[model samples]
Structures are given as structure tokens and as C-alpha cells.
Target: MAPKFGTSGLRGLVTELTADLITDYTRAFLEACPTGGTVHVGWDLRPSSPAISEMVIAAIRAAGIAAVREGALPTPALALSAMEAGHAAIMVTGSHIPADRNGLKFYVPGGEITKEDEREILMRLGQDWEIALRPGALTEGTQSAENYIARYVSGFGTDALAGMRIGIYEHSSVARDILIATVQQLGAQPVPLARSDTFIPVDTEAVDPATRTRLATWCAEHALDALISTDGDADRPMVTDGTGQIVPGDVLGALTAQALGAQILCTPISSNTMIDAMPEFARIERTKIGSPFVIAAMESALLADPQAKVVGFEPNGGFLLGFTAQGPAGPIAPLATRDCLLPILAPLTAAARAGISLSELVERLPARFTAADRLAEIPTDRSAALIEALASDPAQCAGFFDTLGKAEEMDRTDGLRLRFASGEIVHLRPSGNAPECRCYAEADSPERARALVEIHLGKLRDRLG
Candidate 1:
């Protein structure tokens, strides 16, 4: 596999993600599992995922473990099911990667496997590559997909979404069904737009402007309240309000926490400049820019204060915790994974409670223009060199200006972030999961943000070239 363990798990082109590799990885994971624990296997809508799911089931069964197959569900659904069953999960999904690639994300009883854990699994599998003999049953299990959908629907009582209209862009996401079902169950009119049989890869951070214009046109015609879409696996969310403007993930994440009256909020630093705007809400903590990091902090937040309510991460936008405290839904537990359904439902609930449209809720927040772009095929060493070059000589960095009569500060939390004097910031971070260097910038004006990003990228490209 090509760099199996990135920020999440093993992912590669479908051809490179062979059946043998999956079987072996599943076997290795099962071996590492706590004894006698059930293994939940699930997959997304990619054409090759079902076959990979089957391979995992065979491997898990061969290891003498019970297999609860959650066919064609979101990655978070599978994880939640596994956690509910008090077992582990293996999700076969490429997430937001192009249709050409596919992979597996494994979650254990505690959380996702760390880089060290993956290395051990890979080493163990390498030692026993030739031990492929027994085949196991692929028996179908009871449909637990409904129960998964019900969690979101039931959490937000029907009265909250009784009169809203949500437009779902069902572009090859496993959460399409749950998104529609939850809206319907909550008495909202769900209009599914752009339902595709073939995969439509949506880069959450890089939502195209053409798509946004198209959605706006549809909302105007249909008078829809909001537009929502999930990543390939339904773990990440993309939401747009009535104006057809795609709301930044961090803004939606914060609103979700606000709706729940959460005491504690955990998120990454790639969020909007407005996250610090919520001073009235409970404590807010920041983690490294990844779901696993957010999840790890969430675990500690919950542990330290039993009453602490934790919301999940938003790669593009954040996810809300449906059940933080012990509720009738059997202690609505904190999921260590992202669920797109929460962003859609929680904001709708909040909007309903406020008697306003999604656009209004977003308008009430501070104004900031956030944009992200990526330069593919960038080498890791080159990216490091660029950061090092900038850090070593900040005064020599051209095209970056000082404004607002203040000084600039540079932060290297997960990546290199330069905060300008004008509150405008630029970020250059190598994607841990891909061979690309992503550039993000946020400013008071859209043109300013775009211009700042372009200037920095132009300089970096020349250096890398």
C-alpha cells in the first residue's frame, strides 16, 4: 500500500488496495483485538468496497470472531455500531479521495489505531503472508442502518424540523439515505438534488464555486432552506444556506455546539477566526488539525468532567455530539469519529429553535473569508524545505505585507501558519494523507484572502520548482 497510514488509515488506488492486503490487514487487526469481541465490517458506495468488505468479513470470521456486517453505511455509523456492540470496526472507504482510490479505516474498542499500532499490524502481517487457507461465511445480518438513522432523528425531536426544507446533494455519499431519512422523520421536506450513481468526489475544503452557484439557483427555484452533502463515507459534512453560500465547516461546528448548550468544545486550528467569538458558551479547547487528535482530546474532556459535553471535528465543517450525557438512547455516547448527519440535523434544530433560516444563522456570526487550495505531487522534503526557508528568514519573505499597525506571529502547530498584522493569515501545510501541499488563507475580505493565498503560492511554487 502507498503510505497506508496517513492522518487516518491505509488508503491507496483501488488497484493497489488488493484483496489479499485487506484480508491480511483484517486478520492482523482481529488478532490485535481484545479476545472474544465482535468485529463490525462496513463499506461505502465505491464499486470495489463491497468486495473489500467481503474479504474483511471472511478474514474476521476465519479468525474465529463474530462478524456484524453493516453494509453500505457511513463510516461513523459502522464505528458507532462497533462501539455499541462493544467491539471494533473496519470501514472500507476512500473517504473524499478520487474514485480511483479506496482503502480501510480501522477503529478499535478505544479509538483508531495510531501510527505505531499500524506499524505493528503491518509487521505482523508481513511475517505471516503465506497463511491464507480457510474461507468463512458471508452471512447477512439484521439491518441496523435504520437504528443508526434513528439516533439523529430521535435526538432532534420532530417539532424542531417540522417546517424546514433541506436540499440534499446526494453525490455518492453513503450517508444520503440517513440524511434524507432523518429529515423526513423529523417532518422536514427533503429535496435530494444531484443524486449520482457514479462517484462525485467532493473536496470539502475546496468546494468549487460553480457547484455553489448551481446550488443557489436550485434553492431560489425550489425555495429550499439549506443544502447539505456528505463526503464519500458520510463522516465529513458540506452545508450551504438559503443564499447558496457554502458555510465554512468551523462555523457550522460551532453552531452545533451552541445548539446543544455544550460545556466543552474541541476542534482543530484550521477553523474560522470566529471560533473565539463564542465566549458565553462553555470552555473551548483546540487540538491538532485532524479527527483523531480531536477525538483523543474529546476523550480526555469527557473523562475529566463527566458532565462535559464534547462536539466532534469538522475537516471542512465540524460535527456535533448527539448524545454526550447518559440519555434514554443508552448514554448517548461520544463517537470518536465524524458523522456528517450531525451537522445537518443540529443546525436545522438550531435554526428551527431560533425561527430563522440557515443563511440568517451564518450571517449573525462574524464575517471572515476562508479559502483553501492544494498543490498536488509535492514532495514532503520540499514542503519542509519551504517551511524551513520561510521560518529561517521571515523578513526576506516577499509578497506578504504588514497592516493594522500590529506585528505578525508565525505558528507551527500542525503546519506553518503566518498571522499577519491585519488579522489576515496564510497557512502552508503538507497533507499527511496525500502527496500535496495545501494552502489556506482567511481574511476580512474575499479578494484579500484570495490575493494573499495567490501571492504566497506563487513564491512557494518557484521555490519548489
Candidate 2:
């Protein structure tokens, strides 16, 4: 399929992301957004990303916009730099997808582009445009990476994680080095593990069983207080406690917000329902899945109460700071884009401050468990059809979920989220980044949550077969 805009970015098979297509999208983004004269560009470690970055830079220059090449770095790093400079940015990354696929993420001066911006970009595609008199100047910069590291280290303080042993899972994540540096700077003994030259699509939301086993082994071997990692481009974080049990992303969000003393919070509907039980947040808004939606909700929250400390996060552990909040060292600036560092550092620091292990800190929260998995390579159309069938027919929906419990309520914010009579939740949605059917389940216990996801996804697989 041709590259198209999804919930996060424009994505497609690497082969289909030709030079012409990349240039068209790049130019279209420039035309649609208010990009200043200079635009920052960055890429992930994926082999295809370098070439894609070159194409994007060429397109920017051709459009008479100066391009500052930030080299290989995390998406949030590039975004932070661009936002700081009051300019726009383009990141060449597929973000947790296989290396065979690649994509582009665009940011305006303010933050990630909204749905309206995506529509404008699409409308401008293939349209006629005037060429610049000369190619805009191209330059190199490492300031983005530097700024990202400092954002965490300065805010959290050097001793925030003193005496903690943290394992850095360097599995081809562009943020690998930065993670280690930031953790070490915060006084954690960083144990770097499993650095991979080849790109690994580490999905933080759905940690496969094998990767979980590996994380446990690493934590035990290194006597780690916690293990931290990110997705390919590092916008999403994967963090595990001492026992290598991955913390639910929404739970991590809540802890981070609490650490930051946030009063207002925004999250996607797909996130764990436990967020509602947190009494610390004065207001919580649930939007349709996607950072743009969460960002919009955050903007609304800020507008509603300018003094409120606002934050947003995704189920994948990507946190967004919507207001400047006081940190131990200083005041942290707002970064409206999806970020991985804050979530990783805040929770670790909170655990350290409480003189407790990461797992213990998690146990303080409500007893809610969430599990997610996906059936890959299923056509998006097929997944959508299945959802439509269940949504439109109550009998079919009830029958489909009979093995679990009767469907008492349904949420169609982004997909089909069904609440059973027994208080379990089974949500089915098509993956925004790939041809897959994603299943998310929540229960009072981890075992029940995992079983719900497994049983539902297995049923989907059989039906598709």
C-alpha cells in the first residue's frame, strides 16, 4: 500500500516510500504548516531511515527552507529542539514497526501536527509549487540530543536516582545512549545490555513473551532496580521493575503525573481505566487514541484552567508534559509531543524518593491489570469489518463475547471497547501503524487480563482463518 497518514504519522512499506513520494509529502508538509525558515530533521537507526532523511532534507531545501540535520536521534529530541527554536521538524522513523517499513513524523513549531494539519498536507500533495532560487543551506547539529538529555538531568537532579542500579536495554533504540547518559547523570548505575546493530522493533505496549523473559534474565543477572528502554525512534518507553515485570503504561503515566504534581491529565481511551481511580488528578480527560487527540485534550484542559498543571500520556508509555511544573532541580518546560524520558525518569525518581523498589511503588496504585497483544498481518479492512459487525449487532456482540461475560457497555471512541458484566474489558481495534488487529484487555488481576486478551485474539485469528 502507498504511504498514508495514520494516527501518529505517515507510514508504508519501505519499497513504496519512493523518492518522489517522500519529497511530495515533505513539500506538502511545508506548504500546509507554518514552518519557519529553518527546519530540524532527524532519523532513527533503521537502515532505510538515513536515505529517507536525505530525501526529506532535499525536499525542505528545494522548498527554500533551511534544514538542520540532527543525525540519528530520538523523535522527542528532534521535536524538543525544533520547538525550542520556534521552527518545525521532520523525523524519519517507522517507530516499532519492522525495518522493512518506514515512515515520517512531522511537527509544527508548536508541537505535533493536528488532524487538520494532516488533512491540509494531504490536500497539498501533488499540487504545483514554485521552486526556490537556490537550495536552502544545509547544516549539521548535535544540540537536539544535548537539549533532550539536559531536560531530564537538570529537572530530576543528579541524586534523584542515587544508589539505584538500572539496566539499559540498548536493543537498536535510537535513545539507547541518551537513556544511559540520563540515568547515569541522575546517579543510577547504568548497566547497558543487548546493544543491537540491526534495528529491532521493540513495541512497548505489547512486550512479547521472549523479550519479557530476556528482560527478567537481565534484571536478575545485573541486580537491577529497574530496566528501561524505548521503541525504535524512542518516543515510546518500555520500563520494567526489579523482577522484569513491565509496568502498564497508563499506570506509569499516573505515577509520573503524581511525581510532577500535575492537576490535570489527558489520556487515550485505550489506556487502562485505573487512571480514573487516582484522586490526585483534579481533572482527567479521555480522548480518542493517538497523541494528537491527547494533545488537543491537553490544550483544552490548559485553556479551561490556565494554572492547572497539565499532562498527557499514551498506553505505550509516551508521556507529554502540557505545562511547566516545578522539579527538584528547577522548573521543567512543557513539551507537548509524545516523550519517553520524563515517564522513565519520573517514576524511577519517585520510587527512589519513597525508598522503595520500582515494583513496590507500582503496588501502591489500584489493583488494575492491563494486557495487550495483536494479530499481525490481518488486513485493516478485515478488522474494521469485524468491529462493524459486532458494533451493529448486539446479539452478535454478546455471542462473540459469551465465553467471557455479557457485554454490558460499549465504547466507540476509537474502536470497539466492550465492558463485560463481570467488570472485565476487551477492546478490539485495528493497528494504526500496520495491518494488524490489536486486542487490549483489563481486569482486577494480571492473569485474567492476559487470558482475556489471549482468548479474544485467538478467536479473531480463527475467525480470520
Candidate 3:
């Protein structure tokens, strides 16, 4: 069988997500995506992503709809371009997945795909139905790659980083171009370090210590102010300070909140507690751990206060700016979803504004380290049964919660999240995009948080068995 739609989109081994499968998904998605207007296609740097993107574009064309190609832009860049062009867009990226695998993220005219919408696309694929020819033939619209670069460059509004040296660890990801472009736009010099032929996938959830050390050393030797890079598709950011230490995403989020003076901050519960600590008066909205869930909360916050300054999710270090308290059109709606460029530019701007180093600005934020671990590929059926059984026996669940520190609260927006005292929390849920039972914990110490995770996961696994 071809890949089925997960929480985000359809992802599978490259061998499985073939041209034919892309065609089927595209046809079904185009037919079902609430706003059936013109469609656009964008892709990442994976060796196969280009071929798959071409196949996707061809399929869109074959369906008698116009298709615009935005080659090699970050996933969010493509989404923004599509939103601005007033068309639905599909981003071809496995985003931090291994080179052997790939996936697709699609957006409708209004916004990102909801769970129900994805299920509908799968349902359409199951049916042996064909789409009727639209009145027009497919047009390969002009590429907007340069335009996106220019937009990001201009958005920064300064040569604040002029003549500063920046090193981009081009670890075989799609972000290399924008990293260089953004640096150049700020009138700074960009040095490319360590280019590899084989794909070097970096997991945002678990960064390598070796990579961290390498970045730190590079910055010191070159006297560079910062190191900027991104995940496979560049939707998320990974940054380093002048000392070359890799800055975690949660740390970046806090700085962004400070920079934007975002009175209303929205982030996943997996985010650092510092998020809640910073902006003491600002209302922090914590949702289940996913960009979609974060986006939903972002929209709600805007609805409540039109003048409310807002930003949204994931400590993978992506910062989205300009979301006003108002609805979609509220100041930053046209540029909705997480973008890698914001984190890079915001820190630079904040440093310039404060006359301090990037490292110093980061230090100003409350100090915290967040660690996440996942028990991968648990049987889907077993996971469901475990959760159901736990829910059925409230007393047992409560007892477990007591061990964690009496559950002041339980949240099931996306999955079961048990919040404890001591500022420690455990999020136990099946991956919306994978077969894993995932756990995210944040505390004063990485060891304690991870230990808490082990205790919960072991119990769950044992009970399931």
C-alpha cells in the first residue's frame, strides 16, 4: 500500500512514496482541500525531493489545474508565498526524516490541514473516483525562490549584521541557500563549513553533542558572532552563540517573546518553563505538542484580543513574528505558520537594539534545558488499548499521577498530559505522525526529567503488555 496520511501528511520510505502514489494523493487532496482553487508546489533539498516534486507538479497539471513551482524554499516560505498568491500549496519535505524517507505537507486556501481534512484525503484516495477536467490546462507558473529570499532579506530591515562573519554548517539540508541569502542580505559575510555528499539529517528533538562541540569550536576560531542552520526543510532553526554553543529552541522562543514583546505567547507544553516565567504578565497559551495544535491556539488568542501581540510554537527554535491578536489577516496572518527566518533575524535585531552580543541576549532569558525522548514504533493497537484501559480505570491513572506529584491537572487536547508539581511535566501520547509512543519532559535538570519520563513509559509499556 502507498503511504497513508499521518497527523501532518503522508510520509513513508522514498521507495514507497513514488510518483504514482504522489499523483493519487495529489488528485485526492486537490479534490478535497476545502478551497479547490489553483494549486502550487514547493520542494526541499533531499536528493529525491526534487524528483518527487516534479512528479507532484506533473500530477497537478495532469488534473487540469494550474501549478506554480517554488523550488527549494523552506516549507514555511512556500506556504507564505502560496498564501500571498492566494492559492493552496503543497510542500514536499520529510523535514528531518532520514534521507531514505520523505513526506508532503499541504495547506488549503485558508490554512494548514486539520486532522479531519487529512482523513478526507485518505478517504478520497480509497474511492476509485476520478477528477473531472477543469476548464483550463495546467500552467507551470514562474518560480518564486528569489522572491522569497528577497522578502526575508527585506523583512529584517537592516544591515545590522553588516561585515559580521557567520558560519552555516551546511549539513546537506535545504536550508543552506536561505542561510547564505539571509546573511548576505544583512550585509554580513557567510562562511560555509562542512559540506557532505551524503544527507546529514539533524534531529531537532535530540541534537548531537559532537555537532554542538564542532559548532562552538568553529565560531571561536573564526571569531564569528553566531552560527545559524536549520532542519532538513528549514522550517525549524538551530542556532549557536559567539561561543559556538548550540542554543536550544525553547531558549530562542523566550528571546523572541522578549524581542516581540509578545504579551500573549502560545507554545506546546513541551516548551521550556521559562516561557511561562518570561513575560510574567503576558498570557501564555500551552497546547498539546504539535505545530497544528499551536497554530490553533495562536488563532484563538488573536480572536480574543485584536491588539494582542502573539507568537506560536515548538522549541525546535522556529519563531513566527507579527501575529496580532486579531484573526488571520491580523498583521502577520499572511505569513502564518512557523518560519526559520524569524529566529535568525530576531536575535540579530535584538542584539543590535540592546547593544549586546547574541550570547548575552540569550543569557538574559531564564536558564533552562529541555530534554525529549521517544519510545518508538510501539504497536498502534497496543498504544490505543493502553490509553483506553488507563482512562477506564481512573483510580489507577490517578495513582500513577500521584507518583509523578499529585496531578494538579490532566490535559487530553492531543494526548494525555499529566502535570505535576516541581515544575516538571510528562506528555505521553502516540505520535500523530508516526507509530511511536512519544514522551516530552522539561525540568530544572535534564537527568531528572529523563528519569521521570522513564518511570512513566515503563509503567505504560508494562500495563500495555
Candidate 4:
């Protein structure tokens, strides 16, 4: 099977990405959107990424373009450097997906390649374009990691986090070492733990129970101010409370916006509802799930108010800052791509400035709680059919939620989000990155929100199975 485009880029099973396919896909991306003489290529910690990187570099060189390889780094790091150079870049990562899968994210100096851009790449590749597939040697550079760490250090300075203690969960994340280094440069004492080589698919959105227990335990054991982590590619963040529980990503976004005194915010509909109900934002826009949609929405908002400070985030805790904010050390320039560092630092800085703890800072928000989980191995098409049926007619999903209440209102913005008569809510959608059905719910109490997600996800598994 041919690899297909996902919300961020192209992805599929590792077995599906043959050497020839990788070369051709890379060629298609370059041929579709010509760029500078040099193309920056990076990869994640996945075992498949290295091989794919060589194939991509070979393709880049085959096109008579210079290929600058940066062994393995976070997607944001590579993208930011590429943006600065005004050259195109590509990242080989499966993101949070299982190690058996992998993908390539292409960036055109401006940022991530859009849905339409993928279409053009696919069209060019489908034109019977000939490709000679072979591996090639290239000097690996350290610019991606160096610049990424510098971005935080240069903007935040050396001691805003002086008194805080952080536990960095280095779970095979591409940015593991860099995250720890960045934390230390801020003068925070960082406890590095559980660094692994095997890929671990840590979904910051639908956090697993083991991770939940471990973070809280780490805080108590080490007296940590928080535990910081990220997805495989380090775009999505996973930040915790002083008590060890991770704060939801959307909540992190709101906290960041409030701390930065941001004027405009763009988020996916699946984000915490409190974001929509919050009074802090002057302009707020909601789009379908994915970074492309959020970035596009941020663009429209920026156009309407050029001077407005803008930021975008997803439920998975990926933060995208559109303009310079009053960063701790100096003026932080715009990094209009998914970032993990900003989300972690912004909220911590806000809490520090306000004389509060991480949990306390989030607890001050508008009393709304959100929880999400997923049904694994469900076909995307099957999930789509189920979503279409349930969204159009609540009766299709009513039996599963019988204990709660009737579907009072339905929102099909990006998925099937059903508001219950009892004031609880559930949003069901196919995972944009993998073969899974995702469910997110919100309620007045944290327990109820999580329970709703658990029950709904359980029901989905049974039905889909």
C-alpha cells in the first residue's frame, strides 16, 4: 500500500514505505515545490527513520540539490532552521504513532506543507516520474538541536526557573536531550529519568494510566515543581502539576495565552470548552482538528488585526506562537510551527510570576475539565462511517450513552461532538494520525469527564470490534 498524507504529513506502516517509494516521495515534494539549493532533512528516534532519511537525502541529491542532514531532531527544530534559511526541509517521524509506522513532514520556508500541498506532491509523483533509488553519504549537522535550545535560552535567559525542580521523562523522544538541556539553561534543576532507545508512543492528548501514576509519583519523590515531556518528535508537550498529574494540553494553551497576554487564539474544536467560554481572549477562532487548520485560522485572525499577538495549540499540547511576546529574557520572534518548549515554559513562567504552583495556576481556570482516550486498531474508514451515522442521527450512538442523557445538541465541526441533556459532553472522531477512534469529553468535575471518556471509548471498542 502507498503511504498517504495525514493531518501533518505523509504516514503509513513502515513495511509500506519501500526504498523506491521513499526516494520518489521525496522527489515529488521537491519537484512539486522548488526551493533553495539546500534542503534540510531530519528524523525522529524511530528505527525506520534513519533508513528513510538516507532514502530522502538520496532523492534530494538525485535532484541535483544539496542535502544537509541533521541526524535526528524534533520536527519544530528542523522546521524553524529551515524557515530561517528560507529553504525547504523534511522530517521523518511517526510522531506519536507506534514504531511500526513512520511519516515525512515537508516544510516550505513558511511552515508545514498544507493539505493542498500534499495533493500537488502526490500528483507530481503519480505522473510516472522516474527515480533511481540508492543511498548516499552526507555530513550530519547539529544546527537543528543547537538552534532549538538557543531559541529558548536566548528568549527566557538563564534564571527565571532558578527555584524550580523539573523531572524530564526522556522516553525515546527525539528532543529528549535537548529538552533537558533547555531546562537546565533556564537555571532549573532537572532530574532526567527513563531515557529509552525503543520508540514509545506517548500521546499527550490521551495520556496512558501508567504515565499518569508515574508523573505524580515523581513529583512526590523528588519534590518536583513539574515533570516535562513531549511526543516522539517533540512538537506536542506533556507538562505536569506539582502534584504529578499532567495538565490537559488545551488548558496549557489557555494558561500560556493568559500569561503572554495574547490577543488572539486559534484552537481546534476538540480543545477544552473553557477556551471558548473564557473572557481573556479578544478574538478566538475554532477550526477542524490538526495544526494546518489551527495555523490557517491563526493566519486569518492575524490578517484582521496585524498587531495582535497570536498563538495556536491543539488538545495534544503543541503550541504555535505567531508573534513576539514579552518573553522572559528578550523579544522571542515568531515560531509559527508546532512547539513543545513554549507550552512548558510559558505556564511555568506565569505561575512563577503569579506566586503559584502549576496545579494552582490551572485550577484558577473556569471550572471546566476535559479527558480523552481512544479505541485502538480501528480502521479509519470504519470510524468515519460510524461518525457520519452518529453525528447525523444521535440515535445511532444514543444506546451507548443511555445512562447519561439524550443528545441535546450536535456539533460536526471536525468530528461528532454531542452535548448531553445532563450537561456532559462527548466528541468522537477518527485519529488524524493513526488507525484509532478518539473520544474526548468535558464535564464539571474531572472524575466525570474522565469517566465519560472511558465509558464511551469502551463502548466504541465493543461496537467496532
Q: All candidates' lDDT scores?
A: 0.74, 0.90, 0.72, 0.85
Residue ranges of candidate 3 with Cα displaced over 4 Å: 34-36, 131-143, 305-307, 321-334, 375-411, 419-421, 445-465
Q: What is the C-alpha RMSD of each candidate to the true structure, in Å?
A: 3.0, 1.0, 4.1, 2.1
TM per candidate comes to 0.90, 0.99, 0.85, 0.96
Which residues of candidate 4, in runs, are more than 4 Å off? 128-139
The regions of model 1 sitting more than 4 angstroms off are 33-36, 114-116, 119-125, 129-138, 318-332, 399-407, 454-465
Clashing residue pair totals per candidate (backbone < 3 A): 3, 0, 1, 1
Q: Residue 372 error for model 2, in Å?
A: 0.5
Model 2 TM-score? 0.99
Tens-digit lDDT string for candidate 3 (31-133)? 8885356777888778888899988887777677778777777777777777777788888887876777888998887667766687788888845545556
Q: What is candidate 1's local distance difference test score? A: 0.74
lDDT string for model 1 (1-465, tens) is 273666667787788877787877777776655523677788989898898888888778776667877789888787777777677888998887787788888888755665556666766775454443544334454656777777765666666588778898888988888888878888889999888999887777777668878989988888888888888988888888887888777777877777666767778777776767767556677777777677767777778876666676554764747346332223345666777777677776778778888878877777887777777667777887777676667564442333323337877887877786678888888777766677888898767877776776676677676
Candidate numbers sorted by TM-score from highest down: 2, 4, 1, 3
Q: What is candidate 3's CA lDDT for residue 117?
A: 80
Mind giving the per-residue lDDT tens digits that candidate 2 earns over 184-246?
899989999999999898889888999999999999999999999999999998899999999
Which sequence of candidate numbers ranks them by lDDT, best first?
A: 2, 4, 1, 3
Candidate 1: count the clashes.
Answer: 3
List model 4 lDDT by residue over 1-465, tens digit each: 146776778888899988778877888898888566668999999999999998888888877777889888998999888888888899999898899999888888788877778788878775455543542335566677888888888887888788889999999999889988988999899999899978999888878888799888888999999999999999999999889888999999999888777878899988888876778787788889999899888888789878778999899999898888888788778888899998999889878877888888888888899999898888888999988887666576677678777888888898798888877889999987788899999999999999999888888887799
